[model samples]
Target: MEIADMFSTTTIPFSGITLEQVVLAVIIAVIGLIAVKVIASAFTEMLGRTSRLSALIIELLVRFFSILLYVILVLIVLATLGFDVSSVVLGLSAVIGLILGFGLQDTVTNLASGVWVAAFRPLDKGEYVEVNGISGTVTSVGILATELLKPDNTYITIPNSQVWGSAVINSTRMDTRRLEVKVGVAYDSDLTLAIRVATDLMKNDERVLPSPEPVVVVTELADSSVNLSLRAWTKTADLWGAQWDLNREIVNAFADAGIAIPFPQMDVHLDGTH
Candidate 1:
């Protein structure tokens, strides 16, 4: 009795089914898709709030699975219409794969590279990175290309191959970096006093790092003056600030101490009246 009842369907059952059933099935499939989207969003949010790696994996997986689900639902609906789904799918797979392979070869290359990038992490988004002779801040790290924001506020996009092929320089990765400044004083001025002033500037600056310490050397004696090369270490973020401040302090100190900052002094006794 149970088996007979299970197999049974009225000739026109539950509001007399017609093309309306097809429309309703289509609506149900649409509803299923909406539900899939909502669920996927929830899953992503849950994972993102907890573990970043898990969130990334889940995001990628969701994209792949959403397509799979759509295909499965389509196959099930086609089967209900008494179509040969197995043969159809087999034929479609080869044609789809061939078309995709030819058109998306570059995309596949980027996809492979993207996977490696995510795993290895040579550079991260928002870092001030220099590569291939171009210096810029990394705005985005995508599968196909990287987006950089240049110092002049222009956007640049470079292919992933170019980035991975060359040496990547990360400028702001460390806390401290070295600063170099050259000061020239007149040969007539006291060399001892000039050195003392430059050395004192570095010693007094709060921004200057002290472990490796600051250096003041009489690097060269030029025709016009003695060049004093000053090198110091400072926090990376404070580089420009320290440079500006140091220059200002040095200028004021030299003026106060009556030291002469030299320039080219050419003596012409009318070289034989040219």
Candidate 2:
């Protein structure tokens, strides 16, 4: 007998599946799955070998093939079982649709949002940004959630809706930032000396930018102290560093020049009745 005639559904004399036939079908399914695995692996390897290709592109391609491989193998196995799968799935499509609507609506929504984000790129990976109230570096943008690496080394997986809905503040976009520190002096202190020392420190500091020149202005005359505003510019990358260093410089500079950076002191004068 020819091989096709033996396995043909119409020509086969077998009434029902035998132990041998069941074993053979299982073996065929296993081999089919293995073949799919091999093909997908080869495809991924080929894509990976391409020059200067984006990692995301390669990753998406590989994932697609992997998913396709599994699906194809599943269909082949179902076909081997002598069942008409298309008719069955078509009949059940309505029930499947309802199940997906109830159970996966939010998941599907996020996936749509993620696609929008990927296309628009409101946030790129490894960039620092403040989304909503959480400030962190974007670690990964995904279908359902965007992962962020927090300042304290914690990982936050926020949903795509939250990311797209809120305002995003990109702090690292600027090259330099302004540092405003408040200093006060007693009314008796020499105003000229105080301004000289603050401005001198600002000009001399290497981290502080000299373009705008630092403004050492007596901003206000308070009840107890004359408020001096020390406004300086520095590289945005060095903002916190310059802030900590500049305060110490101001104190020492003022003291060395006999200019007292004052503490609030209230004077009470008793009436002559005493």
The numbered model that scores best in TM-score is: 1
Taken over the whole model, the C-alpha lDDT of each candidate is: 0.76, 0.77
lDDT per residue (tens digit) for residues 95-209 in model 2: 8788778897777777677766665667777778898899998878766788899989999998887887778786666788899888898899999888888888888889889
Q: Once superposed on the true structure, which residue ranges of model 2 sit more than 4 Å away at CA?
A: 1-96, 103-105, 217-224, 264-274
Which clashing pairs does model 2 show?
none
Give candidate 1's whole-model lDDT: 0.76
What TM-score should be assigned to candidate 2?
A: 0.64
Local lDDT at 137 for model 1: 88
TM-scores for every predicted model: 0.65, 0.64
The whole-model C-alpha lDDT of candidate 2 against the native structure comes to 0.77
The deviation in Å at residue 48 for candidate 2 is 11
